[model samples]
Target: MKIRVNNDASYIRVFNATANSDKIDVYINDVLVFSDVRYREFVPYTPTFPGDYTVKVYECGNSEKLILEQELTIAGGNVGTLVITGIMPKLMLLAVFEDPNEKTCESNAKFRIAHLSPTTEPIDLTVNGVKMIDEIPFGKRTNYAEVPIGVYDFTIEESNVESEERNDGIRISKKIELKDNKIYTIYLIGDVPDIEIIQSLDIITYMNK
Candidate 1:
């Protein structure tokens, strides 16, 4: 006898001893699908979801019933990538906008930037050995500024320079020569600014206003 089942899950087929045998016993699961037993071969009955199923064959002499069986299953599959959203990080852009009018800090608006660490774990920043802000919120941006004199590279959190990927992070800003007397204003560019949290040392202009 020969039998075959399809992955499409449509149905199962059963066959018997000789090429002429047409009887069959078809079952979807263990339950008999047909009301009557087939002699030579059989065809499946109902439609079903993807899962294991059993098929059986039966032969009855006047006293006992004989049985044959098979198992089957149906299936479907799916796959894709991942996307994420959160707060922004600080970005340092280099720019020279001589506009004296744009000197004040704009508190109403805040921008975000994402800085990647050269190393996985947070870098223990030391500018002559000092501790800065320890927690850098990734994918998010936020900052507050207050400073005086000299160009600063390693950002000072409280008493130290800490490395971070957050808004208050190390950024290569426009090389502004922090002149002793003159004030410089910073402006952002692009629908999507090359950098997010832009900082400028235009204190003289801001104070005069």
Candidate 2:
């Protein structure tokens, strides 16, 4: 008789947060993973082996002009994101670990925010005039905030940029409607006065043996 053992794989997604319009190319361990990825966009997650790997980023069709590189580690049965954030000449990398085994909620929605602008100052996140996340620095992420299903106004302001007596620090504002039983990831991209906030729905499904 013969027996075999199998190991589960980890999953990773990419978020492009640069101000440049050049398409991006992402490589993992010398193998091409994502190609021609656009700025201010999020790519769907792809499966990978659980271990350490060399991650590299370059301008599409111009691999000679490499942009960013980092050594990323993935744990078995976990989910994560590889974020290419900040402006050129000072771009940065941030990895986020999401729980793969998290169950879907039926009555509420969960969301998280990531600050990726290298040139922009720290930020404060507010929803419906109420401060939600404060003093978020570049390459940092806020914990998931749960909210009831509904629509609300979302705003991001530059922290300490203006006096506390005024709201002149406002950077960007938008309206978002949350659906029940869903998860979301929002990314803040680009340089000051020209920023973009992109949102993506996150779907988690485990592979069966």
Candidate 3:
């Protein structure tokens, strides 16, 4: 939370983390104030006449350490865009090849990508620098596929196939960041009904579903 404090007084506010997770530390003006190896979703804390304060969050557990520092400045007045909470830096996106071996998609499967970015609309959902698809079927034949990102270079996948003889046919490639509270989908239609899932990831990281 960002705050603006004036006068020689202290301001009290709630400060909490996921606790016992991202061991957090509190500091004001580069002066260390408090540190907790626990998680508190909304614990209270007081900052003394702060000019510029920061909340440093560090990752704990047997895994690697992830450090995040958020800045806050105090003034006699309120600051604009002072994000209170509910802001996520990263999120998980599920990419599924719907019914890879199903009869509805025996030859080719339709794709429908939806980016649940606060709404049904997307930030940037473009294909081949063209317009967007109105809708895609969910599960039935010629149905749309679901995805997370909007900007897709399906031709990149096409090029991958043309440049090399791929048994799976046309391929697609895209790189987009996933937003929290959003679901992206893709609608696809082809001659082949069955969808074949092929994962060639060099590194496999298991996520705790």
Candidate 4:
């Protein structure tokens, strides 16, 4: 099982995405499994025996009040992600099933895009002025695309925008360098105008051998 927090940690805003930004402790089946997990970070693909478990989240040193709790099932050779989201008092847990088998070569980098902005409209992604993906709605993710290691320009635009209104569309742009042999997840999050582009690297240290 893997754990991650995508809660927005942006500067002094009108309201924060999570109840607090302090580190949290994760408990599985009433036992501590992870500690001090910060925002936008994750524990990737940690192995676990197949079984049923209860996942609970609590403030670092206090277990009196649980922020979130959910039932989890770990089947043989299965991979999954436990995501924490929403603001305090309304915090929620989301589980995602992941593909365990990934065919990756050493010559290029692999990347996938995730549209996580709840209030944002579907978007079209372009790389160096070339369209890579179209009409990706919020809360959805795409399959990985392999590309040579190099710097590339990225732009995100509303999917249904008119040609004449392109200049005033909700366009977000950035440039990034992708390293070879690495896997990345580029996610769009937060509300418009204050949105953030998060590029997370997947580092696999061990696998069944």
Q: List model 4 lDDT by residue over 90-168, tens digit each.
A: 5566544445455457777877877766556898899999999999987677888989988889888889898699876
Taken over the whole model, the C-alpha lDDT of each candidate is 0.29, 0.75, 0.32, 0.66
- Could you report the Cα RMSD, in angstroms, for every candidate shown? 29.9, 4.8, 18.2, 7.7
Best by TM-score: 2
Q: Estimate each model's TM-score.
A: 0.23, 0.87, 0.28, 0.74
lDDT, residue 153, model 1: 42
lDDT of 2 by residue, 1-209 (tens): 11111356666788887786489998888888889899876788777778988988988977787888889777776677788876786677788766544444567887888888777788899899998888998778887888897887888878877656445554788888778776777778787768877777665422220
Give the Cα error of residue 101 in candidate 1, in Å: 68
Ranking the candidates on lDDT from highest down gives 2, 4, 3, 1
CA lDDT for candidate 3: 0.32
The CA lDDT at 162 in model 2 is: 60
Candidate 1: give its CA RMSD in angstroms: 29.9
Tell me, by lDDT, which candidate is best.
Answer: 2
RMSD of 4: 7.7
Model 2, stretches more than 4 Å misplaced?
A: 1-7, 163-170, 205-209
* lDDT winner, 2 or 3: 2
Residues 1-209, candidate 3: write the lDDT tens digits.
Answer: 22333455443343331212345544444444555544323233344453666654434332234354666565532211111121233311112222212111222222434222211111222455553543322221223433443434542222223335644553334544323222223322121222211111100011111
Ranking of candidates on TM-score, top first? 2, 4, 3, 1
**Residue pairs in candidate 4 whose N, alpha carbon or C atoms collide under 3 angstroms:** none
The predicted structure with the larger TM-score, 1 or 4, is 4
lDDT of 3 at 154: 42
